[model samples]
Target: MSFAPEELLACALARLIVARPTAHVAVGAASPVPAAACWLAVKRGAPIRLSLLHKRSGNPFTEGSRELFDLTGQGRVDLFFLGGGQIDGQANLNLIGTGEWPGREVRFPGSFGSAFMYMMAGRTILFREEHSPRVLVERVAHVSAPGVSEPGVFRRGHAQALVTGKCVFAFDPARGRFILESVHPGETVESVRAATGFGFDVAAGVGETPAPTEGELALLRGPVRDEMLETYPEFCGRVFGRRAAA
Candidate 1:
């Protein structure tokens, strides 16, 4: 089955989540893709708990992000999703803005609890749809959240992988560099390297990302897609399709 990029990516991310099962997974704002992936894992029968901070309904937290912070701080959440306006080779995230701080060229929704979550969560997956050199930079103009905290800085964990439109990168915190995991279909390692601003190591046997299977597509379009509509009606309509005649 020919799957859309979003569906393929959802399957890819779901596989990642399934490989390393986590008890509790937290989905943050502007992360419909990751949220869909988490739900897909569950629908596929991978036992894991999903917390959707962006969802209007089905979100258990009545006090908003405060509870999310509490869970991360307490190490109750095993996985969390993070995104950035810019991400560097070292995995540092810049959600604040571009140029100098406080007075920048572009302003994003300034870093709220990202710094805390990035440091607190056992595993954080960075997802971004755009993979151009502009978005993947050699170094961010501003550091909203440092990827690898300084020694004795009290960081519990760091990024595991970065999923983008073109490829998937596994971050090696010890090496402080990203390793090209796999390139999506219709994209080459050379193209991904050319598009990225920073340097990274390509695995010896790098391969194309596996396409979404017919079964996976069925699940994604059915239950997985339905669950997303409650939290992301626009996204569901835009990527999957509009609900059945209301």
Candidate 2:
């Protein structure tokens, strides 16, 4: 079965979820892909708890961010998703945007708990839909959160992988670099290499990211669309069609 690019990416990320031994996942409001992956994991009988900041029902938080922070800091949450306006080979993220500090020429939304969450969360996955050199840079102008902190910094964890539109990169904290894991369909290693601004190690047997299985696609196209409709109606309408009004 065929899936849209976003759906394919979501499925890829869902696979990533399975690759890691996670118990709880907390998805940000703007992260439709990660949210879908969390729901998909549940549908596949993974016995995982999900906390969606915007879900209409089954939202664990009674209030706001305090509980989320508390859970993460305590290491109760196993995984979380983070995005950046810019990410580099070292995994430094610049939610602050490019250009000089104090003020930038193009400023993204200021870092919202990213620095703390990236460290506190047991595993953080950097997810960026755009994978071009413009966003994937050789260096972030300002490091809101360095992927690998200096010794003695109280960081519980850091980024595991970067899932992009083109490929997946596994980060190595020891080596302080990223390793090319898998290239998505229709994208070649050379293409990914050309598009990425930062240098990375490529696995000798780097392979194509597996497509979403028929079962996974069916779930996404059917009940998963309905489940997300409460908090993500527009996304469901665009990606899965609610009531055939597309």
Judged by lDDT against the true structure, how good is candidate 2? 0.87
* Model 1: CA > 4 A from native: 62-64, 242-246
Error of 2 at 25 (Å): 0.7
Model 1 lDDT, full chain set: 0.88
Q: Write one digit per residue (lDDT tens) for candidate 2, span 99-187.
A: 78843688888888888889999988889999999999999988888899888888888898999999999999989899999999999
TM-score, predicted candidate 2 vs. hidden true structure = 0.95
Give the Å error, residue 107, model 1.
1.0
Q: How many residue pairs clash in each candidate?
A: 0, 0
- For model 1, what is the error of residue 43's alpha carbon versus the real structure, in angstroms, after optimal superposition? 0.4
**For model 1, the run of ten residues with the poorest summed lDDT:** 237-246
